[model samples]
Target: MTLHPQSRSERDPETHRAISYRTTGSGHGAIVRLMSPSDLGHLIKPFVFLDLFEGESSFIKGMPMHPHSGIATVTVITEGNLRFEDADSGTGMIDYGGVEWMRAGGGVWHGKEMSPGTSKRIQGFQLWIALPPALENASVDSQYLESGAMPEAGPARVILGAYQGVQSPVRAPDGMNYLLVTLRAGESWSYVPPKDHESLWLSVSRGTLAAPGLVDAGEMAIFEPGNDAVTLTALQQDAVFVIGSATPHPYELALGNYSVHTNPQALRAGEEKIAEIGVRLREYLRQPNDSASVPVFR
Candidate 1:
């Protein structure tokens, strides 16, 4: 994901500093790459890539199988629904507030895991977090969580980390937090980062938000490092968004078309594992029932 810089002439009243990114896409679907490992992602590590996507259910189903390594992907649906299938979890429906977590530790092949639900159109975001050195080459794991299974605090749902004493069930690593929030029009909320959680950013999925500067829908804002609480006011009815905070990742990022690792050696290992899994995935798909568990690297 390439990030073209936007003018930063405005500042949030509370913090008195702000950085913003505008949504850019091909226009075929309302798809946007809000952050990437190269740009804002360098500043906000652990939380690496973020893609905001919405389209007809039929179109989404056409997505081809892809592979990833050295990262964990979080798929959150905000509108419509999707069918999630795996050998371990079987099949489940993911609607609003539902989550699909895939830890492509060493390697994994996916894309056929999700299909259109009952809705005609679907909207959602997929986020990638770079795994730490200890787990970057671990085996793959997955989970499908319904809305009722996720815990909420006030207007925010604890998606990845703890918030206000409520912990998410995602089994994510420590030192990072992700939340999905909805604020009624004219309402306000404040987020105070935990100690050492110096990296903070948010992207709005609908309506407008005022973090001092008015951030319209489809925009993302990165806050300056500080302990100052960030305040946001909804400029329209039911503004929905996701925010993330984390401790800076300590290792350098070794990039690949479909993988991210902490070093060249790890990158090579992950890609080699991916090649080994690809053959198995193809064979599994040829079976009639095709209920085999996704290959996991040990």
Candidate 2:
């Protein structure tokens, strides 16, 4: 579908209005950066950096081990599947609605934790959220949850926060809400933001949605800050997408090539921790028999 900007006059005043919009940009490999720290991330704060990717399972096998700190990554699979292996979680398959959450607290290196599953091709999103000060330097924690483990409220799957009294199993921080939703053609859904949630945006995986304004596939729409409710309607074909809302992250972002922290001191500490962990990771890989390790970005 042809993608273009939507005029203000075209939006319905009673529903949420699109203040800004972004289309995913091409990236180095089989991934696209939907949002990043250098771009719209500043406006969204805690909700920073989003990558949408799709490729054969073999494509992911090429990703090298990397390290991260001061942020948490959430991986959501919308199509196909992935095999997750970790000493703690053992081996399991994550298909549609499945999530892999990794809090790169102090520091950690990963890349081998997940491999291709039964599906030949897999499609999903990886979202990076800046951690709050208290948790940024804590020990790393990870979880792999299957589709059945996530709770559903109406057409939406509660991915990271509470919705309609259903809370997600993921131990995410407060003041944010993320949901995975699917709408059949001609179906409509309305979202009422929590009293404190001021930042809101959505990206569609497939089909078209009229969030009162036409949002084509792969396009992201950022709404004006407010508590006003938003309504969306699927145009043609079934629509699958993710929506997020959060209170502003109340700190400055000290950015690194692979990390984000609230301040420079914290950033430095996180990097130091990552360096220490890298040593252990390399040694572990050297003698690993069947241990599962998560992919780490440099």
Q: Candidate 1 overall Cα lDDT vs. reference?
A: 0.81
- Tens digit of per-residue lDDT, candidate 2, span 23-125: 6555666787788877778878798888888878778788788888999999999999999888777789999999999999888888778889999998888
Score each candidate by Cα lDDT: 0.81, 0.85
lDDT of 2 at 139: 87
Q: What is the lDDT of residue 131 in candidate 2?
A: 95
lDDT of 1 by residue, 1-298 (tens): 4344446544433464365454442233556778777776677788888888887888776677889999999998888999877767778799888899999998988877788889998888899999998888998888999888999988998899899999999978899999989899999999888978888888888898988777777777777765567888998577989988988889899988889999999999999999988888778667786443343322
TM-score of 2: 0.93
* lDDT over C-alpha atoms for residue 289 of model 2: 58
Q: Candidate 1, clashing residue pairs?
A: none
